[model samples]
Target chain A: MVKLTLNVVMAERNITSRELAAAIDITPANLSILKTGKAKAIRFSTLAKICKVLDCQPGDILKYIDD
Target chain B: MSKWLKFGINCVIVLGRISIVFAYLLIILPLGNFYPVIKGTLPKTILHNDNFLLLPGKHTVTAAAMQSFPSWPYAILILIGSIILIWAIIKHLKALIIILTNLRDADYFAVTTVGALKQLFIARIAMIIGDLFLASGNQLTRSWFYLVNNDGVMGATWSSAVADVWMAIFFGVIYVAYRYTLTLKAENDLTI
Candidate 1:
């Protein structure tokens, strides 16, 4: 299963959801869905934009665990 | 899909309601008048006036011709089949109107569309079975359905059901396609 660690990475970087959503040009609702791992899939361009805003790699945001 | 398409659909919905009433009257009036005269409850004098005969246009049936019918078993089948047939038609029109309303509102992928498609698919199948029974019943009661000049098709054979089978298949395909569309929309909505 692919689980997002976006909340942990944002907390570690001292960034609020609103600031990150505005910086990444995404709606707060969608950012919430992503942070809560409710999203079905993430676009590569959107991931690149998020990585750029957060100054982090995709691996820093995404984690896989066996069920 | 067009600017005035919704207007056209609304017109059809109105017309379909009227057609439903006519459908009932057409069948019911003929059966009502036919059975009473056959059983001798209604006087033959009642059918003496041409205007009093309630059969559809270009058709006339004598009480004697009606008396020649096999019996009430097939007549009962006809009544039951007609009821089921009309019910299926009503359901189809209702489902179509609802789905069209959803499209007009720009809610094409709404759950109501799936429900309407499923209803349509089931209704089509019901219509086919209803038509089969009606056709067979009519075939057995052929003497009564004669034309005014005694020159017309007596009754439909089971071969006529082929067209209904095709229609049911068409609706089944449409129902499956709509379900796939809804599934794709669900996946797309959750993607970010």
Candidate 2:
């Protein structure tokens, strides 16, 4: 399963979901969905934007877990 | 657009509640007076002329009229049809109130709203079917009583009901389209 490490990154950067959503130009609800690994897929453009805002690589925010 | 939708839903909710109250007061209330007719205790001639009459006032029927009076089958059918129509109205009103309440919360793309719309559609169809039963029952009553001499003159006109049925069908189609729109909105909301 592909899991998102957005919460860990946001926590390390000392950013709240609302602040990150505002900075990334996405809704807090959608950010919550992504943080909770409920999102089915993420756009590459959105990934690039999140990586730019958080000063991290795509590999830093995403991980693959073998079940 | 949501503002307009809220306003329209509020209007429908108010109108639906008022219609439910009026239906009970005007139609259901007078039905109690016809209990004797419904029970077949009184001579069915009392309802011969007014097949679809909700309330029949005090009238003295002659013995000769009683002898020639038609049976109670048509009157019973009309009574059942009236009950069904009232039931449909109440069901429609309940569905409208739920939909309006959900709309107030800006939950346009909800499954509950779609279910309510489906209920409203079914209620309208039931009302149309009730109207059909009323019309046919009235016609049968008139023919059985051989009261055709006053043709094109007195009695209830069913043309408006026919138009209403057509209007209901049109709105049913619109509701289907709205449901599709809601489905699309749901998909879009989840896409992010």
Candidate 3:
């Protein structure tokens, strides 16, 4: 399974979900979807923006886990 | 869409609804076989066998001919087929009205439109099968214009069967196109 670790990264950077969502120009609802791994997909552009705003690699936010 | 086009669609929807009410007459009028009130109201020109099965010298053989006419299962077949055909046409027309209404609202690309397309496809299939029964029953009914007008008003031959098949194929194609469109829409929606 592919799980997102965005909350962990956000917490490590001492940034709130609202701040990241505002910086990435996404609604907090959408950020919550991503954080909870409920989104069907993530766009490349959105991923690039999130990476830029959080100063993290894609790997740090997206991790592969087996269930 | 153009305003005129929208107006035209609305007009067609209204007309389509009106015609559905009249389409019931197709079944109701035929029931005159049993009901005297309906049979009495119809003009001789419509109910007379001579008008339906006219020969060159057969003008005088009119009145009691209906009593002698051997219309066994054929009449019943035609009635049943017409009922189903009318039902199918009503379904098709309703789906069309919904699609048009959605278009007027600039909401044509919706799951509702896809559902309407599916209903259109199903209605067409039902119509094709129903028409086969109608044409076959009409063929058996034989309007005796056999030599004069091979395919008269009530007597449609297999040629119409061919046209009906083509229509069903066209509906199938449209339904498949909309199915693909729905897939694309779903994928697009997921790509946030």
Ranking by lDDT: 1, 3, 2
Candidate 1 on B1-192: residue-level lDDT in tens? 776897887788788778777766655633663475467543342334343324466366666765565555565665666677777877887787888788778887889989988998898888787778767765553435431212112133466467779988999999999899889988898888
Clashing pairs in 1: none
How far is B104's C-alpha from truth in model 3 (Å)?
Answer: 0.7
Compose the digit string of candidate 3's lDDT tens values, residues A1-67: 8788999999999999899999999898888888888777899899999899989899999999999
Q: Taking the tens digit of each residue's C-alpha lDDT, what string does model 3 give over B1-192?
A: 898998998898898788777766666755654344334422232344443454465455344554444454555665666677777777887888888888878885888888888898888777777767667765543442232223333344466667778888998899899889888877776565
**DockQ of structure 1:** 0.81
lDDT at B61 for candidate 1?
Answer: 61
The lDDT values for all models are: 0.73, 0.70, 0.71
Error of 1 at B2 (Å): 6.4
- Every candidate's DockQ is 0.81, 0.28, 0.54
Model 2: how far residue A19 lies from native, Å: 6.4
Candidate number of the best DockQ: 1
Q: What i-RMS does every model get?
A: 0.5, 1.8, 1.9
The collision pairs in model 3 are: none
lDDT of 2 by residue, B1-192 (tens): 477887887888788788878867756642653675657544554445344343234244456655554446555656666777777778777887887788788776778877877887887777777767666655654443433213221232366367658868876886899889986776666555
lDDT of 1 at B38: 66
Counting clashing residue pairs in each candidate, in order, gives: 0, 0, 0
Q: How high is the DockQ of candidate 3?
A: 0.54
